[model samples]
Target: MRADAQRNRDHLLAVAGTIVVEEGVDVSMRDIARRAGVGLATLLRHFPTREALLEALLRTSFEELTARASALEASDAAREALVSWVRECVAWTTEYRGATELMAAAIDEPGSALHASCVTLRAAGARLLVRAQAAGEARGDLDGDDLFALIAMLAWAGDQPALAPRAEHLFDVVASAVLTGAGGR
Candidate 1:
């Protein structure tokens, strides 16, 4: 891509990321182009599809989450690290409107551009989960997949305006139920 085209692409991605966080993934492409001061055709030339745009917008965050898991392990105890990572996962899922739903779909759909990112996130969560289990901080029966689902549920609660006030309560409940001897730890 030429320098000018690359600049346009970067601008579009940045604007789209903001809009998705404020509005939703379902926001129209035309509106994004309008906000970015570009034509819809130009946007399509860069992203081609809404999924493509979403994948590009969130890839960095997903990668960071994976990296954060490694960093957290070195700094925090097993239980704290797992819980903190769960909190971070919820934050990521709720950072954008409809992100919880998007992540759920992305995790299972092999064809989705965000699928690999989702896989990496699952691995990160699993890494923490293993540490917690080894330390007897989490239930031996629980696995990374379950932890991922827990974060997803918490994020779902966070996204519901009516449920936002109870989001913390929901997180506590899920975390308690998942961790052994935690009692909402």
Candidate 2:
């Protein structure tokens, strides 16, 4: 990773993100290379496959979510933080229409390209869940694994056209159930 190479790699990632968001994952590698101002060979050298490129792109989002979890726990009360984070997770995971199912599959299959990103997402959630449990705001019986499942389900529901309208209501219900001990609040 020399200075010039790093710069080119960063540019590729930036352009790739913009194009993917605007056009889609189906955008051609040649288009990405052209937009990135890099050679096709360079792009291929950096990301050998579409999945590799996508994995690199999604790493940033997963890192942001992890940082957000830490920030929420630092600033908010345990109950409030837990609820807020669940909403954030739902929105983040559903950012791409089909990302929820992709993430769910990645979570189960350790060898998937997105497995590391999924792990980070789950760990961020588990941290929130642990804090809520410690404060007795959430159920002690549940763990981060359970929280992850709930998040995946919520993301899937959020992306559905029919279910989208009911998504917020579903979140409220799920949050309430998780917060079995309101601590008399």
Candidate 3:
């Protein structure tokens, strides 16, 4: 791709990502082009189709999230690190709601890139969970799948702006339950 073409692609991805998160995935491609200061042909040339664009956006986000998760120090205060990572994950989910939904939809589609990314994330999260459990800071019985499910639930709840204020409380409760063996009602 030419330098200008690459710049246009990057701009379109950034602008369209925000628009999709604020609006819905059904937002017009022309609008995306307009916001990106690119022609509709340029946008289409970069993304080809709406699903293609969504998949690319989601893959990029998931890759970034996985990298962040991998960079977290497992040897630190395990409980605190886990809590902080969960909070970060929640923030990402809330900030990219539409893209996340598209990712979920993509996971259900066979041979989708999102499904592959999900698998990678699961493996990395499992490693972190195992390390925390080994350090006796987290529940021994809690597997990666369980942690993933818990985070997904929290992310869904945190997606609502009205529920934003309660996220910390919810995170605390979950952390206590998973780490300290406190019974969460």
On lDDT, the candidate that comes out on top is 1
Candidate 1 lDDT by residue in tens digits, 102-140: 888888899999999999989989999999988888888
Q: For residues 97-147, what per-residue lDDT tens digits would candidate 2 score against the true structure?
A: 566767777888888899988888888888888998888788889888799
How do the predictions measure up, each by TM-score?
Answer: 0.95, 0.82, 0.82
Residue pairs of candidate 1 with colliding backbone atoms: none
| Predictions: Cα RMSD each | 1.3, 2.8, 2.9
Model 3: residue 74 alpha-carbon error in angstroms: 5.0
Q: Give the per-residue Cα lDDT of candidate 2 at 84.
A: 84
What ranges in model 1 sit over 4 Å off? Answer: none
Give per-residue lDDT, candidate 3, residue 89. 70
Alpha-carbon lDDT of model 1: 0.89
Better of 1 and 3 by lDDT: 1
Give me the displacement of residue 47 in model 2, in angstroms.
Answer: 0.8
Residue pairs in candidate 2 whose N, alpha carbon or C atoms collide under 3 angstroms? none
What value of lDDT does candidate 3 attain over all alpha carbons?
Answer: 0.74
Q: Name the weakest run of 10 consecutive residues (lDDT summed) in model 2.
A: 176-185
